[model samples]
Target: MPSGPEVLQAIDWRQPWLAGWREWGEPVAQAVADGLPLHEALNHRSAAPVRFVPQAALPPGEAYERYIFNSGLCPTREGLHDFFNGLCWMRFPRIKTRLNQLQAAEIAAAGVAPLRGPVRDALTVFDENAAFLLAPPPLWEALMGKDWQALFVALRPLWPQARLVLFGHALLEKLVYPRKPITAHVYLAPPAIDTIANLDAWLAADLGADKLAGKPFVPLPVLGVPGWWPENENFSFYDDSLVFRPRR
Candidate 1:
């Protein structure tokens, strides 16, 4: 019998994207290890915004998209993917809803492009590894330049405003093995400090899609955060002159 953190501790925090969910995965991991189904557990949560449907009884294939779109019921299949997805939904309902709307529209429009259009690409990235980043212009510039030190160290005090949310199930699935380029989309917004208590709710703020209009999601190397990844702690990883060297 393993504790929640113990089960989640097995996940590699060295992976930056996963570093975000290390806190939220506890309950889910405990549930999983206990052989408890999340679908039933979801119902009991009075705070849960949407209902969970394990294997969502749909007509199979694309038809299900329309149902989810119309019903607002999040599809919770099996495996770690759906489990993590459920947690993400609980954490980031607004962003997740907006993304679902975008994806469903794309599916309806082009019928799922092989390469995916811009909207779909954006949606996919956010769905898997989006981070809620709030930073001053300098820190933002440092991030854009891939200068980890300036972004995480020199700008440490401003960190309270700077939050990151990992709201993607695919991110967790990938972290099961772990790898580099821990990708995340930096959604530039200041979260409600007191209202949203946890990373899950902070990521799922009650914001609308229009808020993100014209604000292009800046791609980020999530591992660059100071203490987010273990390797990033001693500044060893930032020594990569090829990628993180400050621009002259």
Candidate 2:
């Protein structure tokens, strides 16, 4: 797997708006243009203070929009660069529901038992700003299949400036070989495996604030088996290698 600094250095490193989508399909590209504005796309830092409506005010399908909009304003066009086709529930309902349940269960199981320091560090980054982004698992898996050229074509337009995180058993299978023999049976639905949180209680143990926010702390994929266990003998991140760097 790529080291944290190695990953960070690879990104184009621009504010959100200045990013480009090198290969979006016409319809998806048009949808983005129609839904957001240029200012909203870049320069709008989500951590800045913003008000939000209670869940009661949103229509059933739109509850997730709270994460995308800032104080009820649609994200700027540049900000939309952070949006992924998989993040929207209207586009992937089944996966969304499964992901929520899996996450809730993990937190419940880990309740207050001090998480190992590294995992805590990961969680702190996730919770501090409630940052959100999405990925396409199938596309990611395909890339691991040694189709880097095609994956680059598809993701360039969407993540023009940054190195996208790739985690999950398939990702690992494609990118990093395991230490021992493992089964091909491990896998999770895309939604359940796509998130990275720097702020979950246990995942935030010892990291300083500077390391938990912004550039250095890019998303890291955490692989889980389809039903929520490790597909192989190694299930804990503590047992896996970890790399962290100061946020830029």
Task: Assess each prediction's global lDDT (C-alpha) against the native.
Answer: 0.61, 0.30
For model 1, where is the 10-residue window of minimal lDDT?
1-10
> Global lDDT for candidate 2?
0.30
Residue 29, candidate 1: alpha-carbon lDDT:
63
Candidate 1, which segments miss by more than 4 Å at Cα?
1-25, 112-115, 153-161, 172-180, 191-215, 241-248
The TM-score of predicted model 2 comes to 0.23
The number of residue pairs in model 1 that clash at the backbone is 2
Segments in model 2 whose C-alpha atoms lie over 4 Å from true places:
1-28, 35-81, 85-88, 111-248
Candidate 2, residues 1-248, lDDT tens digits: the string is 34321221232223221122222222333443555332332223122222222234445554233333323322322222223222222222333333333333344455434452444433332322222223455444533453333333444343332233222212222223323222221121223332333212222332233343322332323232112224322333223333211123
